[model samples]
Target: MNGLIGKKIGMTSIFDAAGRNVACTVVELGPCVVTQVKTEETDGYQALQIGFGEAKEKNTTQAQIGHFDKANTTPKKRVIEFRDFNAVEKAAGDTITVDEVFAEGDTINAIGLSKGKGFQGVVKRHGFAGVNDATHGQHNRQRAPGSIGAASYPARVFKGMRMAGRDGGRRVKVKNLKVIKVFAEKNLLLVRGAIPGHKGAYVILEK
Candidate 1:
């Protein structure tokens, strides 16, 4: 899949040609630099390693500096590799813009880290419906996970049982999102509907 590294700028609504309001998520896509190019004969596979965003030199290691030096670019905050990108001809030190890869109405897949919701209960985490009402002896167990295991038959809770714990902050992929608009001048891509991650979080758009 050929794609670009971008940041989830925010979300907003836009009026379509039918004059209907549609919600969309705004993403600041690449202008990424080709840091390394892998070939089948040389590296056993083909892939394009691109770099995005800027990082301070002082915060980067000497080896990393040399790696970026080969591409004739400064330190980058985000580096990702895309395998089998046949859309454009590229080499080390090449620059890839969003317009060159995507257009309006194109369907794309977005991969990103979902927002972290610390420790959560079953109701919010697993969507387990609690006691229907607080009428019959159900005082404080409304949001609790009723029964976990059998008393003496199993003697212990089964593994992989849904329970209250840490939630979110994991890799998530949202597929089939339509590209409502593309702003080449600003390197912004307006994708229809919501995507994973919070504002400013890095996301990968694949076609």
Candidate 2:
């Protein structure tokens, strides 16, 4: 798998050749530095570890500083390892740019953490139509989960039942999103449709 670590900038619309405004999510891809190359003989797996963004030395641990020092780069804010990265052979300290790998119109998958909505109800979280009819003595059940268990038989709620709990803040992968544009100089990529997470969230763009 060929991929890069990037950050979600925001959403914007651009005019296509058909003169229609198409929505695109803007992302700032790397300038990633190769931090380590794990070989099967050494680590029992083949993977390429890359780093992006800058991190303060004070905030970075000594082990991390030594790791980056070996790579001839400073402390990186984001470090990701791609397993079975067989697109091209790269050594530690090498840099990968956005334009060198991706282009316009390519289909890619974006993986990110979705926005966190703390505790929620079944009506909002699980899309339950809670107490829609206000008349028949249903006053406080406007957003209730409504019957959870059976009176007899198992007499217990199933384990996998969709009830109210934590919503969002999960690793979400949006697949088959087309690449709208790629600006190599600015290290920006505009992809079609909305991706997971809020602005400035880290995303993994996989092709």
TM-score winner among the candidates?
A: 1
Q: Write the per-residue lDDT of candidate 2 for residues 1-207, one digit (tens) a residue.
A: 789999999999989989999999999999888999999899999999999889999999999999999989999999999899876789999999898778998999999999999989998899999888889898888888888888888988889998989999999999999998899999999999999999999999989
Candidate 2, residue 61: lDDT: 99
* Counted clashes in each candidate structure: 0, 0
lDDT for each residue of candidate 1 in 15-110, tens digit (9 for 90 to 100): 998999999999999899999999999999999999999999999999999999999998999999999988799999999999999999899999
> After aligning candidate 1 to the native by TM-score, how far in Å is the CA of 120 from where it should be?
0.6
Per-residue lDDT value at 159 in model 1 = 93
Candidate 2 colliding pairs: none
lDDT per prediction? 0.95, 0.92
Candidate 1, which segments miss by more than 4 Å at Cα? none
Q: What is the TM-score of each candidate against the true structure?
A: 0.96, 0.92
